[model samples]
Target chain A: MAEPLLSIEELVVDYGRIRALKGISLSVGQGELVAVIGSNGAGKTTMMKTISGLLKPTSGRVMFDGKPLTGVPAHRVVKLGVAQVPEGRRVFAQQTVRDNLVLGAFLRLRSGQKREVAEDTERMFSIFPRLRERQDQLAGTLSGGEQQMLAIARALLSRPKLLLLDEPSMGLAPVIIDEVFALIERLKAARDTTLLLVEQLAFRALEVADRAYVIEQGSIKLAGSAKELLANPSVQQAYLGAAATH
Target chain B: MQTLQLLISGVAQGMIYALVAFGYNITFATSKTLNFSLGNFLMLGGVVGFILYMTHNWPFFAALAAVVLVGMVGGAVLLKVAVEPSLNQRSAYGWILATLAVGIVLRNAAEVFWSTDDFKFRSPLGDSPWRFFGEPQPDGSMSGGLGVYPQEVLIIFVSLAIVAAVELFKRRTVFGKAVVAVSEDKDTASLMGIDQKFVILFSFMLSTAIATVGGVLVAPITLVSATMGTVLGVKAYSASIIGGLESGFGVVVGGLFLGVSESLTARFVSTGYKDVPGFVVLVLLLLFKPSGLFGRAAIRKV
Candidate 1:
């Protein structure tokens, strides 16, 4: 079998003394959409941050595209084709939407891929037409849903081999959440991106992801194909809000 | 005519303060730290230039270039030795004391090398005043035109040019944008593949370079002394605070306002009270609009 695109082994991360991620391990295959679902403080965000080089793991290793990314700084992680859409969609609020998108392609611009960068920028605008309409507006003024779309589009502008999205459905209206999920579905159907999504919206995430892991208190409690997890009684009881017990 | 002359001189002096305050803004924007030794950098520029040109017989342009290079290096050192370590501790006011210590060290070092006495810095532009429009004197002798020293005019022009150039660079260039991005949100900038530490270091270098240039320009007017930076540095800090610490344009406006007020007081009120208005305005502005005239209050998300 082809090697997994990303591999995390027995990762342990600590914030001072409290272990945020305790002996957690996971992997993503090429062209796969993997969702890790958990409640708040379940180490989902910590895991994503570790993989993207934002946080250092006290023990264990993160191998991305056959590289040990344990001690690499966050800025260098982008060069390895890993883009993270951090929690809360931290767009450059003072900058214009267009500027934010352009900054997403900062590495490309720095490398003098001017023509390609411009083309990709246009592609982003086309993909998110709402963003195109508000291209000149300050990103802070955009609605929450639009900001999330901008964040995702900005990540894609980097043309990453792996997209780490933390809480994409967070703080959105039900209709907006549906729209975001639909966009993710379309992205998955395009089949050119590998995504590791962390979500609190378990049922919705399972519906879209090909495989899912249920993490409780920084450790994986269950892992299975999305269909299996969706049908499993324990997952249904704990996450899906269905009163089912195995 | 007197008022016009005061206005011109005030504006010229104000430009120097603006330059210094602008330096403060550059460093503060990237790292949220201010270099107390900024004024010392300005003094270094003038004293270094004076030593090179007047004492060592170096040409004016060469002396200026050498001073600027020294200022750049001083800025890098200030970042590494003062600002960066303080920031690493994440203590709120640690950098303040650390940078002030650096300034004191620089001032003492200058004293050791150049002596404490103020030395006349010969202007490369010559001491001749440019006359714009002369009026007839009471004794029937023509003495009407407003006369401005060429160095003062140079100060005005260079300050404006630097501000414009920096504004353009910040808005147009990718690297400049990275600096801005780092200033706005360091974590987000890092995630965007920008090295925040490098940007902060570059800002300190730029800040010191600007202060050095200001010193070189003002030296011909104020003369060079090891202690010259003390009052000027305090006033520049005042100018930055009054202008709003975050706003670059605000610093210029604040500097000009403070300069004009000081000049006007010295002329109309009393020369003894010349420095009174800047501090007074600073107090009043702090009481009312702490964000300054052109500064926007920052909004933070939890």
Candidate 2:
């Protein structure tokens, strides 16, 4: 079998005294969507940040496309075809939407791919047409859902082989959450992009993910096909809350 | 006529303060730290330009170019030596002391090399005053006229031009946009593949180069001295705070307002009380709108 696109082995991360991720391991094959679902404070965000080189892991090895990601700076990680839409959609508030999209292709810009960057920006506008209407408006003026779309669009403009999205459904209405997930689903179907999704909304994430991992209190408790996890009685009780006595 | 002269001089002086304040904004915006050595950098520009032009008989433009290049390198060195080390320690006030120490050293070096006495810096534009709107006095002498120095006009023109160019760079270029991105959120900027360290270094270089330009322009009027940057730096800091450190245009407005107030106070009250009005306005502005007249209130994100 071909090597997985991303491989994490026994990753451990600590924030001072508190251990955030304790010996967690996961992998995603080429063109696969992997979901890691857990409640808040379960270290989901920490794991994602560690993988994208935002946080330094205490002891671990992260191999992305056969390169070690550990100790590498976050900016250099993007050049390795890995892009992350960080939690809370941290868009440049004072900048225009178009500028945000353009900055997303900063690596390409630095390499003197001006024409390609412009073409990629136009491509992003097509993917998120709402952005086209508000292209000139400051990203701060955008609504939560619109900002989320802008963040996703900005990440997509980087043209990454692997995309890590941390809590894309965060702080949006249910309808907007569904819309965002639908957009991700469409992206997966239309492109060969590998996705590592960290989400608190287990059911929604499991519905679209090809494979799933259940992380609780900084460690993975279960890993299997998404369909299998959804049907598992324990998962239904813990995450779905279907068999709760209360 | 007297009031108009004061106003014109006030505007010219304000432009110098605005230029210095704008330099403060550049580094502060990028790294959230101010280079206290900024004034020393300005002194270097004036002193270097004077030496190259007057002492060595170098062309004026060549002297100016050499000063700018040296200042740029000095700024980068400051970041590496003073800023990066302090930041690495994660201590907020460490950089304050580090940069302050660097400033003192630079001032001392200049004092040793150029002496403590002030030196006249000849402007490339001749010292002859251009008289405008003259009206004959009762004794058949020109009384109601404006005496404008060519260098003063250049100061005002260059101030506006620098501000406009920086504004344009921030809006139009990819590198400029990277700067904006890093300023807004460093983590997100890194995710976009921007090296935050490089941006910070670039801002320092830009800031120092700007201070050098300010020094060169004002030296003709103010005289070149090792310690000249001290008062100018303090006033520029006040200007930046009064206008809102985050807003470029606000700093200019604050600078002009402070300048006009200082001149008016000097004429109406006493020259000894000239600096008082700027401090008074700064205090009043801080008491009321701490963000500054044109500064935007920071938005809190959960």
Candidate 3:
């Protein structure tokens, strides 16, 4: 197997005495789409936050590309080729759709690739045509699904090697959820982007992700390939209850 | 003719107030903190310019440039000690006191250097009488029966220029766009490679430089004094509260409105009551529309 793109070892996080993540260890290989599924308060979001540098880990190691990421700030993480689409579609609501996308390429300007950046933005528009239609409109006015698309597109604009998404399909219609999933699949296929996704949607996550980790109460209860875990009786009981067994 | 004179004076005074109000908006928008010492920065601008001209014998243009440059430096220093450190600690109140202390120190230091006596600097616009439709006073004053001074015209011109330039920059430049992003959401903006602390410092410097210009413009009419900026700062804050600090356009409109109204009140009503109306408007605005007239209300998702 190729070298892991990201590795977390013995990561511990606390919210003022309440332990959110307890010594969790996980690793993802290059171009792999890894899904982390757990109920609310199960430490999944906390893990993503720790990796992205939004929240510092109390103890443990986060290594990206063989470098320690313990003290890096969130924005520097993007510079190191990791971008996060934060929970709740925090898409700079007051800005125009085009402005939101422009900010995604903030660090790219230093690389002196303006023309390619413009082309990438055009490609993003083509992928999400609705965004192109509402390019001038304020992001706050976009519909729920469109906002989600904007959020993902904004993250993709950074041209990150690894995309970390937190609850991308939350509160979306079933059809829109499928569309978002399809977009994620397309991104991974075309861009060779590594994905570490946190989702509560069990079956859909397993369908898109090559490997899965089930977390509960700040610890990982199980981990395996999608097909193997889907067949595992305990995994089914923990995530899908009686439906998966059926 | 007298009514035209009052209108000219109102516009000039309004221009000065608008600049100060914009300064308040810049720091408030980016940092969500107030520099109660804003007026002192304005005072420093004029005092510094005057010192450069009268004491150091610098040319008018050079003195003006020196004033602006020094104001920018002062703003950066204020940000480093008063704003940035406080922001790191998440202590908003520390910025308030720290900025006020800096202002106090700067003002007193100026007093020691310049003394308290008022001095006149020749207007670059000269003694030319600009009459809209009136005869010069019998005393040969340029009031031209309208109280319009040549320097006041300069004040109006400079104020409009600064506002127009800032608006264009915010719309067209990459740096300006990044500033808007930081103002909208600091954490997310930082995630996009924006150094928000630096942006905040740059914004405060820009605002202070503009305010210093406003001070230099109006210093001829109102004698430059260390204490001159305190009341002006309060009035400008009132204007910001009136305009809605969230929107730049709103801040300017509110400033002009307050300036003209204050001028009218001072002329017709008691000068003491001139600021009263502004403070009343401020209270009413906070009570009724905390977002200001042009500010958009954000929804709390949680």
Every candidate's DockQ is: 0.61, 0.71, 0.52
Question: Per-residue lDDT for B1-302 in model 2, tens only?
Answer: 77888888888899888988899889888899988888888888888888898789899899999989988999999999998999999897899999988889999999987779898888899897777789866885664488888898899999899999998998899999999889889999999999998999999999999999888999999999899888888898899999999988898988887788888888999999999989988899899988888889755343
Given the true complex, what DockQ would model 2 score? Answer: 0.71
Predictions: Cα RMSD each: 2.5, 2.4, 2.6
With a 3 Å backbone cut-off (N, CA, C), the pairs that clash in candidate 2 are: none
Off by over 4 Å in 1: A242-246, B135-142, B299-302
Estimate, for each residue in B162-212, the C-alpha lDDT of model 1 and write its tens digit: 988998888789888888899899988988888888999899999998999
How do all models score by TM-score?
Answer: 0.96, 0.96, 0.94
lDDT of 2 at B125: 92
> Worst lDDT window (10 residues) for model 2 chain B?
B293-302
Instruction: Write one digit per residue (lDDT tens) for candidate 3, span A172-192.
Output: 888898899999888778757
Instruction: State, as a TM-score between 0 and 1, how close model 1 is to the true structure.
Output: 0.96
* Candidate 3 CAPRI classification by DockQ: medium
- The candidate that wins on DockQ is 2
Among all windows of ten consecutive residues in candidate 1 chain B, which has the lowest summed lDDT? B293-302
Candidate 1 is graded, for docking, as medium
Mark the regions of model 2 whose C-alpha exceeds 4 Å error after superposition: A242-246, B135-144, B300-302
Model 1 DockQ (Cα-based): 0.61
Alpha carbon lDDT at B159, candidate 2: 89
Please tell me which model should have the higher lDDT, number 1 or number 3.
1
